[model samples]
Target: MTDGVPTWEEIARDHGRFLYAVAYRLSGNDDEAQDLVQESLIRVRRGLERYEPGSLEGWLARIVTNVFLDEMRRRKRRPTDALPDDPERVLPAAPAADEVYVGLSDDIQAALSALPEEFRVPVVMCDVADQSYEQIAEALGVPVGTVRSRLHRGRKLLREMLSEHAA
Candidate 1:
């Protein structure tokens, strides 16, 4: 971190997992999360010169979110057809034998994915990314009150969905 600004390599090496976690929570899938991280890194490289020294993770989160929202908007404008689930298609490898299963986390993740984007983004930003309301509002270009409202509503929705599953 020279001059209080992280170099691109340093940022990637230090915050790679953090970036992936936030990306995964936002996108709800591994492939999209990987893409988001890659794109975010590219943007970081380009904008490194302009980056101010404060809340590096917050800046990265904002970049990841902007990339996600941009992709969402583009998809909405030009939707694509889903690929047919062909029997001949390759399947992902099963989890390793050493891995422990946690059912509740899966359920929570599914419920989160099911949320509407408006609610989901704030939820992930606050709960997963550990961003502040002001940071979230700045990243999302909304009022702080709106961020708080969406976070409350998003948590309520998640609780309801989880309760339904529990019952």
Candidate 2:
């Protein structure tokens, strides 16, 4: 056995469902859930050479968790304004006051997106990511108190948003 470890495909068949569950909770949607799991598997495969045999499952779990968070981080970034496929043509640049702002228009989506990054991060870490608050504290490089506060604030914000949206 290489490094005394089982093969990746074997372990994946055994554990893929568990990884999918983690992604499903974080994404709150089936399509994105599947994407998270697939991305996680890709990351695991990419880094396989560096993994220690004893840490196989742990490494895989971390990869899955990071993929979910990376999605959220990317969602927060401004989307590109350029249409990259047109290599031979270009449009005239707008004047000094023009700026493109692109994002979700629906109130519900906006509300979720508007939650403070700090609050949303801890809630997802503890709830959707299925990580212990202590683990979240370690991963976030923050005190447990900070994690607790963020989680509480996040839940409160969601409650308010949902109630408002339901009206």
lDDT of 1 at 143: 100
Best by TM-score: 1
TM-score of each: 0.88, 0.57
Q: How do the residues 12-33 of candidate 2 rate in per-residue lDDT, one tens digit apiece?
A: 7977877775565455445566
Off by over 4 Å in 1: 81-101
* Pairs clashing within candidate 1: none
Which ten-residue region of model 2 has the weakest summed lDDT? Answer: 95-104
Q: Considering only N, C-alpha and C atoms within 3 Å, which residue pairs clash in candidate 2?
A: none
Question: Model 1 Cα displacement at 85 (Å)?
Answer: 13
RMSD of each: 2.9, 9.6
> What is the Å distance of residue 86 in model 2 from its true position?
18
Q: For candidate 2, give the lDDT of residue 107.
A: 46
TM-score of 1: 0.88
Give a tens-digit lDDT track for model 1, residues 67-145.
Answer: 9998899878766522325644346435455333399977877899999999999999998889999999998989999
